[model samples]
Target: MTTVHGSSYRFIWFGLEMVSLFIHFTCLLPLLIGTPVTRAFMPRLNGATFLGPSNALSPVNVAHSRNRGIFCMRSNEMITVEGVSVVLLAGGVGKRMKADRPKQFIELLGKPVLLHSLEIFSTLPGVNRIVIVLDKSYRQEFSFLQEEDPRIVFADPGKERQDSVFNGFSQTLPDASVVCIHDSARPLVSQSAVLASLRDGSVHGAAVLGVPMKATVKESADGEFVLRTMNRSRLWEIQTPQVIKPDILSEAFALVTEKGLEVTDDVSMVEQVGRPVKLTMGEYTNIKLTTPEDIGVAEGFLRERAEGKL
Candidate 1:
C-alpha cells in the first residue's frame, strides 16, 4: 500500500468536486437555455398537416392547409401553465387603410382600436406581461396604458411584421413560458379565443386562432385565370392571437433568421421548423381592420356585443 500526502488527497477531492459540478450543469443546461424538450415527445410531420377544429377538443375530423402542419390531441386533456406574455403587434403604417393615422390608432367605439385588444389582455388572467410593438411616435399617445397597468410595456417596431414580432418577444418577461401574439387591428378578438389559443399553445407548443372559411376559396396561378378550387370544409381563415411556447418560438425564429425566411405570421415561424400548430377555432367577427370600411363594421360588432346580440 502506498501512503498519499495531504496535497494528493486534497487534489483528488477537488477533482471529484469538479466532476460533480460538471454532471450537475450538464443536466441543468437544457432548462437554463430554454431547450424545447417537448420537441422530442411531440409528434412529427410525416408529409401531412394535422388540424384541430376550434370547437372540438378531441380528434374528430381532419383539416388541411398549404402553410403548415397541425396535431390533434390524443385526449381531451388540457395542460395549463402560468406566466403568459402577450406580444401585441401594432407596428403597421396601414398604407392600404389610407387613414390619417395608423388603423390601430383609429377610433373604434370611444377609444383607439389598439385599446380594445390591450384592455382584453390587461384584464386577462395568467397574462403576466404585455409587450406592445408600437412606433416611438405613438408611444406618448398610449402612455396612459403603462401607467394603468404595470404589466404593459412598449417595444419599438421593426421593418417587417416578423421583425416587429421579434422585437416585442424580446421584451417578454424572463419567466414567461408561453407567448400570445395578437394583432392590434383585430380588436374584437374574444377572450375565449385568447384563452383557447393560450391553452392549446401550452399543450401543443403552437396554436393559431382562426375561423372556418365560409366563402369558396379559389386559387389563381395567373392574375386572370382560376387554377384550382380549394375544399372549403378543409380550409380555415387564419387569424391572430397566435400563441406559442417561448422556447419553441425562439427556436423557430432563430432558424428563420439563420435561413433568411420570410413569414407573415408567428405560427409560420414555428411551421418552418416542421412543428405542428393547433388551429383553435376563432370567430368571423375577429376581422382584421384593413380598409376604411372595416372601422364601421367593427363598431357595429362592438355595439351588438354591448347589447348582447352577438
Candidate 2:
C-alpha cells in the first residue's frame, strides 16, 4: 500500500480532473461547432474489412461510417470508449532480460518501461481508471509511484499471468462497465487501437486485437522435424488490450475457476464459456519486449517513430 500527502495529493488529483475535463470539452466542442475534428481509420481491404468499423454491435444504425477508405472524425463524435478500467500486468521477473531490476522497472527512453504504457492509458478519454498488478516483491519498489496518479490503484499479482489479471480484476470498481487487460511490456499500443477494441467489444460481448499472420507456420510432432504447413490466412498473431463487458468477463472467469482450467489469455476463458470474441484492427508496431535484444528493437522503433519513419 502507498500513502499520498494532503495538498500534493489534492493537486495531482485535481490536475488530473482539470486535464480530463479540458480534453473532454475540447474534443466534444468540435461536434457542437460542426467540424470534422478526426476520423477513425478502419480496416484496409474492402472485402475482409478488419480496419473499417465492421458492422457495429448496436441494433441502431450508426452514421459517419466510411466505406473502403478513410473514416474521418467529426468534432461532435460521441462514439467514445469511456468509464473503463485497464489492468496492466507487470508481474513477471523478466528473467530473459537478466536485469538487476525487473524489466518493468528498467529505463526505456527516459522513464521506466512500464511508464510508457501508463502515460498513454492516462490520457485516453475512454479510460477512467488504471490498475497496475505487480509481483509481491516489487510492491514496495512501486509503492511511491502509485501516489503520483489518483486514478491508479495497485494489486498483488499471482504466480501466473492469468492470476495477475484475475487479482487485478478483483480490485476494479463496481461501476466499471468495461474491463481491459494489457501487458506492461507492450508500451507501443496505440490509443486508437485500444479504442477500437472497446468500441467493438461494446457491440460484440468481447473483443481483442490480433495481427494477421504473414509468415509461414509449421506444426511439429516433436523438435525433430516439421509436420505440415499451416494455412496462414486463417491465423492471426494475438496481441493485448483484450476488452470485454464486465459481466461477461466475470461469468467467464467463474467458469474458469469452477472447471480448474488454465488459460494463457482472457479470450480463452471467454471462449470456454461459450462467448464470441471478435478481433478488431490493431497496429503492427505493437511488440512485446521479452529479451535483451528486444530492447534495442524497441529503442529503434521509438526512434523511427520520432523521425516519422515508422
**CA lDDT, every prediction?**
0.82, 0.76
Distance (Å) between predicted and true CA of 55, model 1?
A: 5.4
- Flag regions of model 1 displaced more than 4 Å: 1-78
TM-score of 2: 0.75
Worst lDDT run of 10 residues, candidate 1, spans 62-71
Per-residue alpha-carbon lDDT of candidate 2 for residues 8-38, written as tens digits (9 for 90 to 100): 9899999999999998987887677874446
- Tell me the tens digit of each residue's lDDT in model 1 across 1-310: 9999999999999999999999887767767777544332333344433333335542133322223222233344423346889999999999999999999999987899998989888876577899999999989988988898898999999999999999999999987878999999999988766766776788889999888889998999887999999999999899989988989988998999999999988899999999999998788899999999998999999999999998
Residue-level lDDT for 168 in candidate 1? 94
lDDT of candidate model 1 versus the reference:
0.82
